[model samples]
Target chain A: MKESFSQSMDWLHTWAGLLFGWLLFAIFFTGTLSVFDQEITRWMQPELHRVTPAPLDLDAASRTLNQLAPHADRWVITLPYDRKPVGAIGWQHDGLSTLKAIDSRTGTVIPRRETRGGDFFFRFHYQLLLDQPGIWIVGVSAMAMLAVLVTGIVIHHRIFKDFFTFRPSASFHRSWLDAHNVTGVLVFPFHVMITFTGLVIFWAIYMPAGIQTRYEGDMNAFWAEAELFFEREPANQPAPLVSLADLEREARNHWKDGQTRSIVVEHPGDRHALVHMYRRSDDRLSLDSGRVTFDGAGGALRAVWLNENPAYLTQSVLTGLHFVRFGGSPMRWLYFGMGLAASAMIATGLVLWVVKRQGRHAGADAVGYRLVEGLNVAAVAGLLVATATFFWANRLLLPDLEARDLWELRIFFAAWSLCLGHALLHEFLRDGASLKIWTTQLVLAALLFGLLPILNAFTTESHLFVTLPQGQWHLAAVDLTTLMGGLVLGWTAWRLHHPVRTSARSCHTQPVSSSSGSIGSS
Target chain B: MSLAAFLLSYGGLFALCLAMPKHYRAMCGANALPPRPVLLMTRIAGWLILGLSFVASVDAVGWAFGPVQWVGYLAMSGLVLVFGLPYSPRLVLLLGILAFLAVPLTIILI
Candidate 1:
C-alpha cells in the first residue's frame, strides 16, 4: 500500500515478465513462423515443391476417395492453393477415417512424409503440442502478457520522448533496456492487438461462462449459433451424389469468382447428403468467407450462409486479425517482422533482468540469480537450437519411417533438453559465467540454420539453387530466411564474444539498481 | 500502391523523428533544437504525409484492410528509423528521402 502505483506496476512487470517471458517468447516466435506455415510445409514436403499449376482434378480425386472408402459416410476434399499446390482427400468408413495427399495435377496419391509440417509450429504456438492443459497454460501466459504490456507502458513514463530512441552504444544493461523499450513502443499497437486477439480467438475456452449458461455447456450448440452452422441426420436411403466440380463451380459463381478452399460431401450415399463449399479467406480481412451448402444428391442450392450479424462479424474479424490470413505475402512479411520484434522485446527484457543484477551478483551467485540465468540461456538460446533441430530432423529422418513426425518432435525436445542440461552443468561447474553456454548453443543454432539450405540441397532437389530460378518463392523463402537467421545468430554470438567496454562505475550507474529488485525499494 | 503507402509511411516517420529535438540533433549534428517555425513545419508535414499514407493504403486495398495495413507500415517504418538511427543515421535519412521520392515515381508508373 505504501508503494506508488508506478513502483507497484514495475514490480508486477518485472516478476510477471520473468515468470512468463520464456513461454511468451516461444509463443510469439512460433506464431511469427506460423505466418509462413504453408510455405514451410511446402519446403518440408519435397513431393510438392515441383508441383505444376493445374486445375483441380476433382473427378479423379473423388474417384480415388470412392475407391478408398466406398461406404464412407462423408467425403472431403481440400483444393490446392498458391502456397501449397497439393490436394488432400479424406473419407470416413465405419468408425475410421482415412486421409491422403494427392497430386492435384496428376490425381494420384503421393506418399508424402508423415510430418506435422508447419502445423507443428502453429499448434505449438497456441497449445505447446499438448491438449487442453497446454491451451489453459497458453491462456494464462496470454493474460500475463496483457498484464506485462500494461505495466510496461505504465512504468516507462517517457513514452513519447523516447519514441525514436535506441542507444546501442550504451552499456549492456542500458542497451538492453533501450532495445526492449524501442521494440515495445515502436510496434505497441501490434503488440496490444495481437495479444488481445490471441485471447479473443480462444475466448470461449478461456471464459466459458457464456456457453455454460446459455448453451448448457454444449460447445456444438454455441458454435452452431455463433458460426451459423447447421447439420442434419443422414437419411439411410441410398442416393447418387452430385459432381464436386459442378458444386464448386456453382459456389464460385455464387461468390463472384471467389476461390473454393474446401468441399465436404456429408452423408455422401444418403438421400439427405449435403455438400458444403468454403470460400477462401485470401481476399477478405475476416476469416469467415461464407459457406454455400447444396443438396448433395441433386446438387440443388440449400443454404448460403454469409455472416452478417455484427457480433459474429466482429468475432470473425478479430480471429482473422489473429490468424493473419489476409493481405497476401507482403502482409505476412509485415506480421513476421513485427512478431520477431515482439520476441526480441521479450528477449531483451529477460536479458535485462539478469544484466541489471550482474553487478551486485558478480560473485554472490545467489540461487535465484543462477536459476534465472540458466533458464534464460535454455529458454532463449536453447529454444533456437531446438527449432533448428526440428528442421534438421525433418530432413535426416528416414522418409518411410513409421510415425516420423513424432520422431521430429522428440528430436526437438531432446535437443532442447540437452541445451538445458548443458546450461545447468555450466551453472554447477563454472559459477557466475554463462558465456560459454550462450556462445556454444548460439553457434550450434547458427550452424544448423545456416547449413539448412545445404542440408536441403543434399536431402532434396528443391533447394535454393533449384527453387530460386524456377520462381518457386514459397520454397525459396524458407531457405533464404533460415540463412538470414543463422547470420543474425552468428552476429549476436560475435557481439557477445567482443562485448562493449564495461566498468564498475557504469554498472553502478545503471537505472535499474539492485534495490529495484526488492519490491520495497521505492 | 501498397509500395507507395509503405514508402510514404517510412518518410512520414522519418519526418516525425526529425521533428524531435534530440533526433534532429542526432541527424543534423546540431547541439540545439531547430527554430520554432522549422519544428512546426516538420511536425505538420510528418503527420500530413502519414495521413496521405493512410489514403494510399486505402486506395491500394480497401476500407476493411487499408487501416490495418497503414498501422503495420507505420510500425515497420518506425522500427527501421529507430534501429537505424544509432548506427547509420545518414543512410536512414537517405532511405527516408528515397521513400518520398519513390512514392511519386510509383504514382508515375501507375
Candidate 2:
C-alpha cells in the first residue's frame, strides 16, 4: 500500500490501465477498427452494403431536400462512401429533430439505417455511456496514458540500445519486460503526443475552468467560437430567402470534385438566415475545411471557411494532430503502427505484472499472482474473443429485428463476460493457466470466425466472392480479418503448451521460467 | 521528395538504422552507432535533418508550406529516434517538446 512515487505510479498504472485497460483496449482496439468504421458498418449490413460504390447523385439529393423540407433553412446530406449506399439527411426544425434517409434515385426517405447496434461498441469506447463524468474519466485516462508514456520512457534506461530487441524465450518476466520497454520506447513520442492531444482536443468540454474564467462563465460564448457558430442575428425584415442551391454551386466551384456534406442554417426565418456548408476536397486523404457561408435572405455569399494552418486555435491544431486528418494514409499508418505498439506495451505490462508477482508468491498457490493472471486472461485473451464474437453476432443477427441494435451490443458484452467467466474457471482446472485459457479461447474464436462466412451464406445468402463488385468488400474484409485473428489465437494457444507435450520430462523443472508463453510482442 | 522531405525521411530512417543496433546489440548487427564512422554519419544525418527542417520552416508560411509540411514528419521522426538515445534523459524531454509542438507541427496544412 505504501510505495514510492514510481511505485505509486506503478499502482496507478496497473489499476488504472487494468480496470479500464479492457475498456481502453476495447476502446482503442475498436477505435483503430473505427478508423475503418464506416466501412465496417457497411460490412455489417449486407442489405445496403456495397462493394463498388454508387456514384453520388448530388442533384437528385439536392432536389429531394428542396422538395422535402423547403420551409426549413438548411439541409445536411452524407454522401455514400465505399461502404453504404443510402444517403443520410437531417434538417433542423424548431424543437423537433427531422432525420431521414433518401434513396439515391427516388429521393425517398427510407427507414433510418439499421439501429446504432454495432456502433454502440465503437461509441462506448470514447463515450463510456456514463455521460459527462465519462468524458472526464476517458480524458483523465488519456492524460494518464500520456503520463504512462513519459514515465515508461524515463524508466527504460537503455531504450535506444534495443530499438528492435524482442527476444522471445528470454525469461517470462525478462522477455515481457524487454517487449514492454522496447515497444513503449519506440513509440513513446506518439503515445504521449496523441494522448495529450486527444485529451486537449476536448479540453473545453472536459476541463472548462479556463474558458469560464476568461469568458464571463458563459459556455455558449466558448462553444460559439469553438464550433464556429456565429452569434445569432435579429430578424427585423421579412425578406424571402434565396435558394441554398446557389451556395451549393459556389462550394462545388471552390472545392471542385468534392461533394458538400452539410448546410447548417443558423437563425432560420430571420432577416439574415446564415447557411454554413461543409464540403470535402479531392487532393488529400481527409475532408478539408472548405466550408462556405451565405446570408440566406439577402442571397449574399459569406467568406469560405478553410482551416488555417492549425495555428489559429490551440484546440483546432490539437484536434487535427490527435485525430490524424493531416497528411493522409501514410501518417495514419505511422500512427496506427505506434498504436499497435502501445497495445503491445500494455499487454507486456500485464504479463510483466504477472511474471514478477509469480516469483514473490511462488508457493503452489499465490493469490496475487493468480489474480493478476486471471485479469490477464480476461482482459487480454477474453477481450479479443469478444471482439471476434461481435463480428459473428453481426452475421447471425437479423438486420430488421426490432431490437436488433440492442441485441448486437448485448452479444458483444455477453460474449465478453462469458470469456471472463471462462478465464476465471479455466486457470483453476488446468495446470498451465495461460496456455489452457489461450487454447480454449483460440479454438472457440477460430470456430466462430471460420464458420461466419458459411453462416452468412446460410443467413443472408450474401457471399463475399460475389459481393465484391457490389460494394460489399467491407463484409469480406471483416470475415477475412476474423478468420485470420482466429488462426492467430489458435496458433498462439497451440504453442503455449506444446513443449510440455513433447517433453514431459522437465515439466517439474520448467517452474514458470519466463515469458508466461503468451503471444510475442510481434 | 523535396530536400526537406528527403532529409526527414532519410534522416529518421538512418537514425532508426543506428538506434536499433545500438540498443539491441545481441539481437542485431553492430549498427554504426557509437563507432567513429557510424557516429559521424549519424551526426551528419542529424544535421541534414535539422537543416532540412530549417529550410522547410523558411519556405513555409501560415501552415501549408510545401517543403515544411513535406519534411516535417521526417524531421520529427528522426528527431525522436536520435534524441531517444540510450541512457539519455534528453530523449524523454525531446519527446515532451515534440508533444508540445505536435499540434503546430503535425497539422502543417491544418
lDDT by residue (A305-371, candidate 1, tens digit) is: 7777898889888999989889899889989999999999999999889877765653445667877
lDDT of 1 by residue, B52-100 (tens): 9999999999998898898899889888898888777778878988898
Q: Calculate candidate 1's fnat.
A: 0.66
Candidate that would win on lDDT: 1
Supply the TM-score of chain A against the true chain A for every candidate structure: 0.92, 0.80
- Please provide, for model 2 over A1-522, each residue's C-alpha lDDT reduced to its tens digit, 9 standing for 90 to 100: 433766866666666656655555655665556555555666665665432345545566656666777656455667654335667676766655565656766556666335453455547656766667777778777766766666565556566655444434445555567667766665565666667776766776877787778998787886555455454554655565566666677777866576676666665556867777787433342334567778867767766656554544455655556555445444444555566566667777766766665545544566555655766777777777777777777766665777676687788789889988877775555533655676677677777776776676676646665655565455666666666766766765665555222222221112344444443211
Angstrom error at residue A242, model 1: 2.7
Model 2 TM-score? 0.73
Per-prediction count of colliding residue pairs? 0, 15
- Model 2 residue A335 CA deviation in Å: 3.8
Q: Against the hidden true structure, what lDDT does model 1 obtain?
A: 0.84
